[model samples]
Target: MLIVHVAVTVLLGIGAFFLLVGSIGLLRFPDFYTRLHATGKCDTLGGGLIILGAMIYHLFQYPETLLVSAKLAFLIFFVFIANPTATHAIMKAAYKTGVKPWRLGEERR
Candidate 1:
């Protein structure tokens, strides 16, 4: 039980770290496309991992409650669908707005 708790804590911590890194990248990265890439990939991964850790913790802590498990599964499913769709929408909007990608070796003017 203690081990499970520790593992869950560690996983959640890692997920939080990734989320923070993604946010910083979104602010610090040059160009819109690069920022979008960082936010989309890292944020989704962080959110997924965080949800997974929570689900694991809940399963271990409440084995008899199928309702909690089902709820967590549903949350994960929604996030998996929503995050990618949001990212796609952002990318599509950027493309339509003529937001250009940052070319390698090209200095920001």
Candidate 2:
């Protein structure tokens, strides 16, 4: 269906856009913490939306593969939970290890 295709396209596009934003932030941000923050938020949502698009597409295009969609849903959930948790853990580790945040006029690490 045209509508279904459009919806899938939109989700995929938004997901890709977020992914791009995350990558740019990773490259452009001044410091490690900020980069981590960028990727953590954008990547989780981007990856989740991409997977959601896949799940939706499969649900409509292959009705018998409900199991596939269910599995993808689990994957989406895992990414949503795991990425942020992992990011926080890493940030905590960085803080504990005395990895300093960037201040103004400092050279990039």
- For residue 46, model 2's alpha carbon misses the true position, in angstroms, by 0.3
Cα TM-score per model: 0.87, 0.96
Q: Give me the runs in candidate 1 sitting further than 4 Å from their true place.
A: 105-109
Q: Give the candidate number with the greatest lDDT.
A: 2
What TM-score does candidate 2 reach? 0.96
lDDT of 2 by residue, 6-94 (tens): 99999999999999999999999999999998999999999999999999999999998799999999999999889989999999999
The alpha-carbon lDDT assigned to residue 22 of candidate 1 equals 96
RMSD in Å for model 2: 0.8
**What would the per-residue lDDT of candidate 1 be over residues 28-85, giving only the tens digit for each residue?**
8888888878898888879888988999998999899978988988888898889889
lDDT of 2: 0.96
Native-vs-model 1 lDDT?
0.87
Give each model's whole-structure lDDT. Answer: 0.87, 0.96
